[model samples]
Target: MVMKNTESSPDLIDLIFKYIEEEFPEVQDRISELKPTIRKEFSGIETYIRQRSMTDRENQIREVMSLFNGRNATEVARRLNISRATVYRCIKTSAR
Candidate 1:
């Protein structure tokens, strides 16, 4: 026997995850206008958070690399607990 979906559209099956979006006020305007399923809103908000986190991490890597006085990439990466590829990429932009 199959259960019927009543809250949402019959054609679409949505997995609604209830969480606190109130804490993130900045995401309000971005997702509020969305007419599609709330799932898409969650995806948009999540993407924003992820991108911001990546940006913050990159900035941190650059700062840490600066304190290294432009030393070996491997050592810097090892100390920072990041990958050699990441360190090498940051080295290009970071002050050598």
Candidate 2:
């Protein structure tokens, strides 16, 4: 549960097992038995979080703004190889 910005998604899965072992030694065996399911759930959550993180959105805006000349979100999107909608969204977000 002590997540760090430097830790990748897979690292969270390993951290969970370590936490369980440290905090609930008696249940370690039971948790190990459910490792596969736990990892699957963690992976899904990681994907969800990565997609929704504000840091990621900010990065997108930074990239878009770097290439923006005030009127070329489409060109910026093409240069960045991202969706036009994504560029537009970043523009809207940065405006706030």
Candidate 2 residue-wise lDDT, 11-95, digit = tens: 7667768888899899887876788887776555634345457877788789898888888978998899999998888888889
Clashes of each: 0, 0
Candidate 1: where is the Cα deviation over 4 Å?
Answer: 1-17, 21-55, 69-71
Off by over 4 Å in 2: 1-52
The alpha-carbon lDDT assigned to residue 27 of candidate 1 equals 61
lDDT of each: 0.58, 0.79
**TM agreement with the true structure for every prediction:** 0.42, 0.48
Q: What is the lDDT of residue 81 in candidate 2?
A: 96
lDDT per residue as tens, model 1, 1-96: 987767564322122211223565566565544426555544534232254576787786666667566567677777888777877667666644
Q: Candidate 1 deviates by what RMSD?
A: 8.3
